[model samples]
Target: MRQIPLALLAPPTHRFDNFLPGANAEALAYLRGLSPGDPPVLLWGPTGSGKTHLLQALAEHWQAGGQRVAWYDADTPLPWELPAHESLLLLDDCQRFDAGQQHAAFALFVASAGQGYNIVATADVPAVDLDLREDLRTRLGWGPSFALEPLGEAEMRAVLRREADRRGLLLGDEVLGYLLTRFERNLKGLMTLLDRLDRFALASKRALTLPLLKAMLADEKIDSDPNL
Candidate 1:
């Protein structure tokens, strides 16, 4: 049997509006002010901290302005070509970059400095802790750096309830607490889990609760990885 692609099912999107600021309101505000020729910005956070969301949102914002955006991730293969003209450079997952990617990223930094293009990059750790070459790592700290943090417990609960209410789905207090503790704490992971539960609850004609959520995880086999 052929399986349907997840994109066609529900393509993922990252918009500034969808992000819950929690304690990152100032950081969010900073990103919105970005434009062509802005200095590089470094955003560092653990998984589920919405770093990816913000980076992609930047991409969309630039593209909407009819500015060309060049994207490169640590997972992207070698021979990575830099854009010829001045363009927005979005570098993601800098912590995982190998030696070759590090060299390319250093070049991108030079481009942003010399060519008047804006650059934004995300990593799992702060610049001082980044394990790349010294000069490249130093370049990462050339501009404003924000440490994106996970939402507090109360904030996460509120966000979950707001999302559930927006979707007209019922989730209990127990369910919310369980999600915060048992699953990943990042916004994207929690939202994905909530989306999954929404579909599962509808299909099974069941009221969402802690027990049913556990059952769904058991059947789905995604709970083995906390970051999933």
Candidate 2:
């Protein structure tokens, strides 16, 4: 029998379809219907508000449609030369960009104008609050801006349930309720914890139940392993 690696059983793909838009319905619709001539989009929200997921979804959407797409994070240096034709550019964590990166980003923004290129960027705060240069900040706000709202309790629960279903885990209502009440509230953190629980369940051949979850936490405490 071939053993399946943990890497192969990693988290589900982040797509627009699985996203629970809640109050961001308009923003979701806008991104879904993006075209070549569409204005650049600025997505700002609190941390863990699904900004990165939306950017990834947009990149995937463009890539699937045979469009040239480039995805970049602020931690890395932005390339000076970008394609001049119809291209899709996605930048995440814009709040962390340094002065040099900001200059490069601004140049890219200017080069993309009226060139059939669409840029989508995400930041923890609005353009006015970003730590970038004044010109870059103004350019960031020149396009449509959407503030992604955090998922509410019911929405979070729905997301958890949907993720569990994708992994073929028949999580009981009691288990889901326990997780929501006892674990982290942020979707990303909760999803990480769920991944750990799923691995533990598979290794121990135990069904996902409240008791099993409690046991797994106890084992992590004893082992003192951060990954657990």
Candidate 3:
């Protein structure tokens, strides 16, 4: 398929490069081969499962390739009736919207398919079970689907390594292991924990050690449980 000339579909947003082991490359490969004929894909995973990252990565990849892609969350109208281009549409958190959006999204899917445009959406549930129009449900099943498995311990470690590298933080294995054992196994939780530790360490001008880490975590627990 010819690359679409990028038009003002949507503005770029922030994206992070902290994919777990074996996941970043796989998701990238999936998007690289995508054509308009590829069915509208629905990525189902719990919050902090890297669904957003994968979708954002795909959007960025397409944008960089000169494809006219529109990316937004469920808060926006379905771009069903927009003029067609070599485009990609990324709709995030569709589950939060009303049923009308689902039906409208189906119409957009039809338009995109006709023009060889790509549509990628994400939700907490599988597309088949999403409260959407029947036709939309059927259309969603026509494409390839992928669910991100919850990160395992080693995967979490890998994620920590990647995130630390991205942020240029010197996170030691001992500190990472300590945080992992005491925290929830979700990316958001891990990031929050790391942010606090980094901030506290910086403010106090102290190296991230076990005692400093414990005090920081203990103080965080007072406001509420930091574990999500």
Best lDDT among the predictions, by candidate number: 2
Kindly indicate the candidate among 1 and 3 with the higher lDDT: 1
Q: Which run of 10 residues does model 2 get worst, by summed lDDT?
A: 1-10
User: Per TM-score, what order, best first?
Assistant: 2, 1, 3
Error of 3 at 166 (Å): 3.3
RMSD of 3: 8.9
RMSD of each: 3.7, 3.9, 8.9
lDDT score for candidate 2 against the true structure: 0.83
Pairs of residues clashing in candidate 3: none
Q: Give per-model TM-scores.
A: 0.84, 0.87, 0.77
Query: Per-residue alpha-carbon lDDT of model 3 for 51-120, expressed as tens digits?
Result: 7877877777777777777776667765445545677888787777677677677677777666677778
Global local distance difference test of model 1: 0.82
- Superposed Cα deviation of residue 74, candidate 1 (Å): 1.5
- TM-score head-to-head 2 vs 3, winner: 2
Estimate the TM-score for candidate 2: 0.87
Please count the clashing residue pairs in each candidate, in the order shown.
1, 0, 0
* Tens digits of lDDT, candidate 2, 183-228: 5567888788888888888877888998888888887873323332
Residue 18 in candidate 1 has what lDDT? 73
Encode model 1's per-residue lDDT on 98-170: one tens digit a residue. 9999999998787568677888999999888999998888988888899999888787787778788877778
